[model samples]
Target: MNDKPPFPGDDPFVDSPLVDSHCHLDFPDFQGDLPGLIERARRAGVTRMVTICTRLRQEPAIRAIAEAHEGVFYAAGTHPMQAAEEPMASVDQLVALSAHPKFVGIGETGLDYHYSADSAALQKESLAIHIEAARRTRLPLIIHSRDADADMADILIREHAAGAFGCVMHCYSSGAELARTALDLGFYLSMSGIAAFPRSAEIRAIFAAAPPDRVLVETDAPFLAPPPHRGKRNEPAFVAHTARVGAEVLGMSPRDFAALTSANFDRLFTKAARTAPSRSGRQE
Candidate 1:
């Protein structure tokens, strides 16, 4: 059976330049299709994307993907679910990794009590280390939070209080209180394919309530593929679908919303923005 969902329609924001703020291009799902996947993303007006590395051991491979692709960047950290299984990452080690030009963010790290509640303490410890890395490297913290909103909020609030660090709640589907807390801390909330589901009105409402300037769009590909491609494997190209939904939620045109989120991404991921080449093959 063909699992690929039909494209919604002709592209509406053909001229809009977008960025996939979070994804995992190194995953085996895209093993032999990187070039085609990237071309589709370009055709969808996705000019840049950050491929995240959830485990430190995979950083080399992730870095290579970013290096091989002109518009791709990467971030590395121990994923919360893998906290107990992996060697604890040190702030110094993460800081060292940040020295790469394409290494732009600190983590896809945070709390994931849904599947790994037994490792909550380890996850928290890992999160604190990633937070410190983000602070030291002056890079945005890419957080993956699920079923641990309260602790996530508390830790983020406490960590920020000790010393400020930039962050983005990747695939944010948490409660309003956590959304407010993240926004109050000046962190960005990334809308993933989940936000585009027909049953995601509450998630859409949270985005609607957030400051447009503080919101971003991502695919989190090979995972949550939004409608029109809902049940198929996701890719960076599919981020535009989520962006379209985000545009509707925020009452902006597709092109405008794309530009808005791209700007927001640039603001938070300064390293990527600073070094990313303009479409003309010139430094931006």
Candidate 2:
């Protein structure tokens, strides 16, 4: 199943040390060209990817992708919307399935109010289960809070107070207050390439004031593609734009930005650790 190429490359920007903290490499959009897609990502400076789990039904497909790629990693949990289909992916199931070495994080799970309101309630319940699994497994939770900030906050605060766990609010589209609550509970905020868009002033503002150690960059790829590639399917390589944009927001060079956020990713998602070569694979 291994298809990774260790050969050195010809591209300049492809050698930087950057990581795309989240992406859906298992999705059908990527299924046709897993090897080439991963190669392109590597050539674009993306060395690692946490392929997300959206439904319990898709775990096998996602696992297969991770098994085939050398540096690819994955998570196991039904996303909020999947609660309907997998009404029983209990905290125990999440904790149990997470024993696999490649199962590094606990979710792409959290509230997403873009659909049904009933789904929102189901989403919140699912989030609690993932949080509990995260607490038990001590893996960082990959949160996906959307328009339900009030509910999302209430749940995080309540569960965190009950028993603490590592968490990262992925793609953070919420406001300052929600960000404050997540930070107050020791959660890292993962910024996607969306922050690079001109319309992301509020998201950038949150990044401007976030604690350095608590800020991580992501692509959420095959979705959220950065500028220059906006409206297209995103890939791990696009994480470079996130680091670049994040650097601008934090007032640092992209290299320093890459190093900083890579360190932050390691800090928060510890068990999913990495060791890059001295030569960073990402360049401007």
Ten-residue region with minimum lDDT total, candidate 2: 275-284
Q: Rate the local accuracy (lDDT) of all candidates.
A: 0.90, 0.80
TM-score of 2: 0.91
Model 2, 199-245: lDDT tens digits are: 99999999999998899888887898888677888878777767778
Residue 79 local lDDT, model 2: 77
Please state the error at residue 125 of candidate 1 in Å: 0.5
Q: Estimate the TM-score of every prediction.
A: 0.96, 0.91
lDDT of candidate 1 over 182-263, digit per residue (tens): 9999999999999999999999999999999999999999999998878889998888889889999999999899889988
**Model 1: ten consecutive residues of lowest lDDT:** 275-284
Q: Pick the candidate with the highest lDDT.
A: 1
Colliding pairs, model 2: 15-280, 15-281, 15-282, 16-280, 16-281, 16-282, 17-281, 17-282, 222-234
Residue 277 lDDT in model 2?
A: 26
